[model samples]
Target chain A: MNGHVYIIGLGPGDQNLLTLEVLSLLPTLTDIVGYGPYVERVEVPNTVRKHGTDNRQELDRAHHALTLAQQGHRVGVVSSGDAGVFAMASAVFEAIDQGDISLKTIQVTVLPGISAMFAAAARLGAPLGHDFCAISLSDNLKPWELILHRLKLAAQADFVIALYNAVSKARPWQLDTAFDLLRKELPTDIPVAFCRAISRKDEHIELTTLKNAKSSMGDMQTLVIIGSRYSRVIQPLSDCNPWFYTPRSITKK
Target chain B: MNGHVYIIGLGPGDQNLLTLEVLSLLPTLTDIVGYGPYVERVEVPNTVRKHGTDNRQELDRAHHALTLAQQGHRVGVVSSGDAGVFAMASAVFEAIDQGDISLKTIQVTVLPGISAMFAAAARLGAPLGHDFCAISLSDNLKPWELILHRLKLAAQADFVIALYNAVSKARPWQLDTAFDLLRKELPTDIPVAFCRAISRKDEHIELTTLKNAKSSMGDMQTLVIIGSRYSRVIQPLSDCNPWFYTPRSITKK
Candidate 1:
């Protein structure tokens, strides 16, 4: 019996962003597995069995998919953004590592998708045009001190920073603390973007400065971008959105 | 007369990776402007004019696209990966910044696509499953010293580093110099992935240790991923590809 697992990224809440490979393969899958929200995002055929779980249950979901694949069923594991970036790819691999040796025979492939950082950057102009880094602000997996350290180093390196999972109901003060930490090394006037629900209906984009940025501006769905020293905003002509871009070359003094 | 410029990413090599928005909007464009290779990659309708330019002439190409838009032509400016990441989006905006005031009235939007870094990462399991940064290795725009400095800092911060424009004919030594610099801060055993022509026919993936990595392993089309300290490789049962992933959490001993 042939069995395989395809870990796919749906791409930042927009159905149109789904890759042709993913769109073509979705109809062939026997089972679709993911977090409730991400699983619902894919419009699979009625014949496919859907297994949805909470966001925190990635391991369990990954194991379930693996079990199905091992049982000779082609399983589709979905993630909202690119699967390799803080998503199900790692969870699936980790599960496979801990599982029985027989599970290693199941073929697994991770299909890339448009991540939130790129989606947010496109909407807000090319603030990430130059060197950039992405660090998740959530401390659920790593300690807060490590996160703060990475933030400071990133600022010192002058990377256009993309912070994922910036604020959640359980961790309200972390983003504020991160801003405070960044303020020490970065200029207060640098542009900070709080992009919520990017590429989705009712999307909101808040263009603020480091000094004026607040934790209330973001939720778990928000992807926050802090511009590098070279990042700038071009004023709007009238009511049009302001264009933000970092020049490709930086003149060295 | 309505005039607009659409800066779009074709995604990493694969036609299937093109977003539905890009596919649907291609037929509506009056002209397509981009590097010769990228321009040829798009399957435009015969009615749409194709203006292909040399790669190093980004500014001139951007100006040309803007000129066509000003002439009431709907223009599509194309890039290979995500437009915002080391691509044409910045050049178009930079051109607009320096051009006539009337140019600001022309509508502009950037459509995101799957970047090579993400595509390569997905193909190589999940090497970028943590905090990461992408730095271009070419010194054509920035100084070699700055590139070396950023590589050192990125290593110090323990980032999963994605090196773009890794090796080119004019600047082959830059990549070798970068690896030597990284050797000072990063351990010798960290896994490095040289992924070439991601998502396309004749794609090649080479997994090696940092100590064993060579400049010859990469070229301009290659996306090199250097895993963080936490990254590990999962051995396959027999003939299947080995899985590489970094755990989401870091245990603070």
Candidate 2:
């Protein structure tokens, strides 16, 4: 019984965004497990045993996947976006590290996938061409102080930022605070784009400013993209949605 | 005679990373064009006419694709990683601007795909989980001063920085200058991860400090991932490669 684990990235909610690497490995997986809503994105064949739970139940799912893998099951833990980008890859490793699970015996390979930042960037244009970073506003795992420190750092850097887990159920005010801190460092006119439920049936993308993002953004599904000083939003034509771009060259003379 | 343009994203180098969204649209394309090296990553069928050229020839290719599309041909413009992130999508828009191409008549759809940053993040773990930015050190398009300003901003913000086009044939020391500026704002001890030819053969990933990165990097194929103030490089027991992670929670004790 050869037990191996493959941590797969399902991409941002669309089956079409799944990489061929992940798709090719689906058939070989004896068990597919992840956050329930994310696992539902993949159309797993009936042959593979599916194990899914809520987001808070990640540790439980990882333990189960590890147990199954140790018992000779070819397990694949799926995550939305890139599995390693605020996803399940780290949890799996942490779980593996917490115990004496001999990773030497079991093969573990992490397959990369499309992330929400890339999905959102495609819809909005190239606001992220220059320096940028992706930060999660959810305070579930980390302290808000640390998050605030990171936000302040991002603002001072004038780096375009892709914000993940921006506004969630329990953490509604997180984005507002982040926006406030960002506005202090960035210009009030800085361009901000919001992409909600990207690559999904009800996907919505809109452009605004950091000052106005609070009223414009609604829930956790939204990914906020804030541009640096160099990034600007341009409306191609009348009645056209504004697109973001970072000028290739800036002239000082 | 419908002239349509499908802007596709080819995942980081390896064909396996190409998304189903890009894959499903491949069969419908009659003309495929993109940056020379990236277009070679995809397998275009014999029926589809392929056009590939250097980065300098990007505007020409976009014009060619648009002209073909206007002539009632379905054209697909491909780019490595996501189409929007320093890829062909901007060139298409630039060509449209220069030539006054009527986008209203042409059914142009910009589809999302994975980016090199996401690929690098996935391979290296969660160094990018918080606020970050991507900067290109290529002086061909942007002036070195603007790049320095942006680097200064990123450093002040303490955002994780993903550097693209860091080193090339002409601009050898641009990365060194950028790194030096970054050191001014950030502590010299900040961890930096260099990922070369990710998701491809001869892939190399190493963790070092900003001060030591200049000698370690290679040509255009490499991606530099600089950790945030809180990020650290940990030597995981299972793998020889250094792993980076930002703690899920940060406590102010």
Candidate 3:
């Protein structure tokens, strides 16, 4: 039995954002595994064994999927947002590198999905239309100092910055500190957007300036988009909220 | 007649990579507009009017889309990857900002699609699993110095870098300069991936160390992914090329 493992992203929130490639592959799996919420997002027949665990269990889930696949199961691993963007695709690769020897040869195919940054950016009116960087604000993976260093340098480079995992109950103070740092480093009042639960029924979008942006506006589901110096905002008279975007062409400094 | 405009992405090259939302939106467009190749990619009914143009006329296309929408047409503007990332979303927003007052109030919706970087990274096994930055090498919009400045800062921050619009016949030497710049700044050898025409019939993925990367391996359709210090290569023995990824956690400095 030549077992195979497929890693796929479930997109931000809406099922509509899932790619046809991933959607087509769902029925061919014999087993599926992921974080509880992401696994719940997919619909498969009962014949396919479902394995869902709590958050912060990436390595464990990856190992489980690989082990199952090695045992002649066609396993599918799911992740939120794009699988390669700060998600489970790496965990599976890391498992292949450091796990049991036999698990290394499992055939793995990764399928891309809509990432949170792009999903939120689309709703916010193309705020990341220019050069950009995505930095996760969660300090669980990296040092806070490094995050600050990147924030400063990214601002200096004038790239539209997308902040993932910006705020959560455990780390309420971090995003606030990030805002304070940007205000001091930026010369102009850049446009800022707090996008929460995008594409979901409870979706909330707030537009503010960097000087007035508050960390309280966000939560774990929030993805913050901060525009560069050249970014601008437009208030169309169509009763909708103001839209923000970074222009493609930048004039001289 | 209230005119509505929608800006959507066609994904990398395959129609299967398109999100369900974008696929569903195509048939509803009364008129569709895009670069010639992208416009041809959409399968629309004969009743739908198609507007195809050359490459460098982003401003003109945006104006035309807005004008069509104002005449009570449901117009769709198609871009190659994610509409918001170095694509037509920002151009449409720019047109609204600088165009006629009537165009500003025209209702427009931007839909996100699978971007080239994520598509290429998925094919290459999660090269962007850690903190990452995307920089465009094209100097048509911004100055060359600004691109170099961001490259230096991004590498200094140890970001997994995704270089878009990496090469073209017009600028043959810029990608080579980027490799040289990274080599000078990096302390050790790093894995670099040259992913060209990802998901197309001519798709090519080449994995090489930073020191061994050559400019000739890419074209305008290529997206170069440079792994950070935390990124690693996994040689899963499945008759496949080496897989690359950046682990989620960064151990202490």
Misplaced by over 4 Å in model 3 are none
Residue-pair clashes per candidate, as listed?
0, 19, 0
Lowest lDDT 10-residue stretch of candidate 2 chain B: B234-243
Question: Residue-wise lDDT of candidate 1 within A131-240, one digit each (tens)?
Answer: 99999888889988889889988998899999988999999999999999988899899999999999999789999999899999988889999998888888756457
Ranking by TM-score: 1, 3, 2
Q: After superposition, how far is residue B91 of candidate 3 from its true place, in Å?
A: 0.3
DockQ each candidate and list the results: 0.81, 0.48, 0.86
TM-score of 2: 0.88
Q: Output the better candidate (1/2) by TM-score.
A: 1
lDDT by residue (B51-159, candidate 2, tens digit) is 8888777778888898898899999999888787777777776665556636435556787777888788878766765556778777677667767876776766566
Tell me how candidate 2 scores on lDDT.
Answer: 0.76
* lDDT over C-alpha atoms for residue A128 of model 3: 89
Candidate 3 colliding pairs? none
Q: Please state what fraction of the native interface contacts candidate 2 reproduces.
A: 0.56
lDDT of 3: 0.90
